[model samples]
Target: MRPLSTATLLCMSLIVPSLSQAEPRPANMVYLRTVDPTIEQDIRYATAHNFTGHPLDGYEAPQCLLSLDAAQALARVQASLKAQGYGLKVFDCYRPARAVADMGRFATQPGDPRKAEFYPRVDKQDFWHLGYVAKVSNHSRGNTVDLTLIGPQGLPADTWSPAASQADCAAPYGQRWHDGAVDMGTGFDCFDERAHTDSQAITATAQQNRERLTEALKKEGFVGYSKEWWHFTYAGDGAQKAVMDFPITAP
Candidate 1:
């Protein structure tokens, strides 16, 4: 083969660096909406409607990205629930590693503007010890998700604003902030024992709702976290193990 000319070699150098600098999303990861548009998504971290009172790092868009395997499994769960006049709604999925670090920083910080509605009874510093937040989250691996069940009887979710009234997360279903989801003992991200998956402190109706959601997800190889009723991690084949830090972006 002939030796490359000077201009050809220069052009090759520029192309090589550009390609090397690119950090395209892995082929195995995908947005959940593409997998199942019917499933509802209310990605809280993408907005300031979460425990942190601010959007975490790497969440540029409110989209549910997950491992293809986990997304497929969740879609199956959504399908099964639809037959029973129910649907799945996700709060978070595929959290970036930087977001996890942001959570850690939030726990140590002084501000807790949203504490009344998210973690009313727990101290922000105790979030890690109480198992409400993790230093290394499985969500970064793209197989875990925080979700809730929506049914015909659920009250309409009120639009949250900075001026909205703050209600304790553990308050009775009707008295608390209505997230348009069935009562599961406590609201999402409630750092209290009432949010425990098998806690008996809740009403029978709430217990039944938790069980229904748990069983539906379990059938698809997703395992629930005992501490947080809304948290589940997919443990089936093709589940990702390495943590990912890709920024959540608008498609």
Candidate 2:
């Protein structure tokens, strides 16, 4: 083979830097919509509707990206729920490691714009101690998700504005901000005991709804966190071991 000319080598150097700068998503990761377009996604961290009241780092878009295994399993769960006149609506999936750091910073910092609604009963500094926020999240492994169940009579989700009226996350289902999901005792990211998976403090209907969601996810190898009914981690094969930092980009 002939040695490359000076111009050819110079051009190659220029192209190499640009190519290396673009970080490609891991091959094992996939957007959940491609697996099941019917599964609704409301990626909270990509927007200001979450507890932080600001879009977190590394969330460039509101999309559900999960491990291929988890995505397929969730699709199967969705199919089962659809047959029963219910569906899965995911709030978050495949969170980047940077987002976890952002959450940690929020917990320690001095801002409470969303405190009235998301963590009214608890202090922000207590989020980590109470298990509401994790320094290292399983979601960064791409096999965990936060979601809710949507049933036939589910109300339309209200658009959240910074100026919207705030309600306690543990408020009665009808009184709290609706996310078009079935009543599961408390709203997503609620930092109260009532949000516990087996909390008996909630209404019987909410208890039943939690159980239904739990059973469905359990059947598909998802294990629910006792502290949050909406959180589940896929424990089946192909679950990612290493946490990822890939940005959640637009499709």
TM-score of each: 0.91, 0.91
lDDT of model 2 at position 140: 96
Clashing pairs in 1: none
Superposition error at 97 for model 2 (Å): 0.4
Please provide, for model 1 over 1-251, each residue's C-alpha lDDT reduced to its tens digit, 9 standing for 90 to 100: 99999999999888775645645678999999999999999999998988999999999999999999999999999999999999999999999999999999999989988988988888998887888778899999999999999999798998999668388889999998889998789989888899999899999999999999999999999999999999999999889999988789998
Q: lDDT by residue for model 2 over 129-226, one digit each (tens)?
A: 88988989999999999999999767789988877739888999999999999888999999899999989999999998898899999999999999
Q: Which clashing pairs does model 2 show?
A: none
Candidate 2 ranges with C-alpha deviation above 4 Å? 1-23
Computed on alpha carbons, the lDDT of every model, listed in order, comes to 0.92, 0.92
